[model samples]
Target: MADTEVQFMDPLASHSVVPSGQQKQVRGEREPDRTESLQNTGQGEVEELLLSSSAVVAQAPPCGDRAACSCLGARWMERSLESMELQLQLLTSKADDLHNWVASGQDHFEREALAEAVSRFLYNCQPYFNHLEYLRSHKSQHTLLPLDSYTWLVDFSQQLCDRLEQLVLTYASYNLLCLDETKPNSVSPFCMGQSQLGPLRVAAFRYFKPMPYLAQVHTGLYKRMRWNVARLREEQREEGKNERVGDTEYYFLCYEDIPNADAGGDGNAVRTWSIGKWVQVTPGTDDIYDWIMCEVPQADYRRLLFLGSDEPSSSSATVRLQQMLSSHQTAE
Candidate 1:
């Protein structure tokens, strides 16, 4: 497959290709339409939905120590929830808009434009998911920290959890649109597939471009992969410091087939890696100041990590698998 460029969706931008009249029609209110730009429409809807969603999150019972969780206060929770909820709203709205566009039917160019927009919108949500999981795990551990220091922790986590649920729903809707034959222009980076090795879902990582390698991994296999960490230290470099950073280790979450030992040893099996799980690997070190490591449980479908090279370099990533295979050879 050719390399695909990952586009970032600027929630704050006001650009939209939809005709002005259609934009007004979608808003459904006359009053001269305050949100003149489609970007604004997306941003505005996100803001409104996030506020409503945050209220729902706030009402839910608190998870960590309320005293230590400063962000959980009614007002602060609402404020902190803005960024995440806005992104979720923007993506979902984009999906909805694209669906309507397909339903209305359009020229080939218009369909291509809509497909690109959907791809970008869906890809951008991954980082927010990673950041949210990092926040949740850290806040849960810092129950002793004073509220003033991390005022937004509790609220951030709560709103993140809520928005994540919304993301799953929105992703499903978007995927369906891709699969819908009626919407001749629908497209996505992922597809549903199953085989004897087990069900496997794949996503291409733009940062690790052109990683054209493939292998079948069996279940119960543990492997560690390493990749060079990119760093920018102009100030340190100016002061005679080396800017190069060493590679770090992260475990790969591979999908394996599980035999149906429960079915009277019939030898039937199923794959266990749940879809829609958050799956990015990040390694933090004492040298890195802003790094956030996540400790979310791997067992939950929501916490599931994705396999996309799972590291920066394709060749280096295969080292662990090589070791596993070599060991197996010796044992045999």
Candidate 2:
């Protein structure tokens, strides 16, 4: 499995978080205040709200035998096989829309306009994240897409982001001992890394939505701890030498809910991803001036994040995402 071919996927595209066991941790400290959400609005609550079942109650025992674990996993895979096909169909339809939108007219003109179009399309699509009215409180939908699935998608992101933020606060409390806690403990500094990274979480399952398509994305955060360009490259390079790479090495969970293909290409086969959130497929995704001038509600994504390396500019990143997504559609 270590030598399994890596599919071309967007780190920002919607995806699965790393598995619970294999996840790598960034900090070993503790922070309580940040964990309030996890205490109140935790995975158990979220699962109950969505699955109408408690993950604790539903969780299977760690089988005594690997063959047994594999057997159970295989059964789960068989059940999801059909859902995966449905997800594939939805992807094709969305890709078709993108192609037509581009080919329809030169009139959509600005990247801003295209971004708006993408937003409109998503709203109509019923993206996830609808709030439950079981309690007396529920906030109105804010910056994320207005679609139902997109809403859940945002909720998914929000929950994970909140989890990570809490982790940061918690870890900040620790002197950096490397927390290795029980299930409830989660990896510190960023629990999302432990809870939401990896393709086993990412590529292995298909998303499902009962309202629209039979299946959608099955799979698929956070500030602070910024690293400078030269420093980051050097750090990452050093980590590589030691056979260590990105923490949690979990880029799949944050995959933008777009096609697996992006705008640029190294000519490898493209892999379609699950539903994504806040896609940066168009330029000006980070254009502060354009957003201000257009009167778009500033997303808390309001702050600019400069993740560009010498290899690609932020705009190129978006374009490359588009190209890769397009290529994936073609390949499919």
Residue 8 error, candidate 2, Å? 21
User: What are the per-residue Cα lDDT tens digits for candidate 2 across 234-296?
Assistant: 544444332223322111112222333554554444322222223222234446665556432
| Candidate 1 lDDT over residue span 1-332, tens digit each | 01122232222333233322122122234323322332233444543544454454445335566663544543444443455556555655655665566456565444444444444343334444433333333334455544442434334433433343343334345342343212333332221110010111112221111111111222253222111212324554356343333322122323445677788888777654311222232323233332433322122113234444223232222323333434544776
What is residue 52's positional error in candidate 1, in angstroms?
16
Candidate 2 deviant stretches above 4 angstroms: 1-47, 53-152, 176-326, 329-332
Error of 2 at 110 (Å): 56
Q: What lDDT is obtained when candidate 1 is compared to the true structure?
A: 0.35
* lDDT scores in order: 0.35, 0.27
lDDT of 2 at 62: 46
What's the C-alpha lDDT at position 303 in model 1?
21
Go through the candidates in order and give the C-alpha RMSD of each one to the true structure: 15.1, 22.5
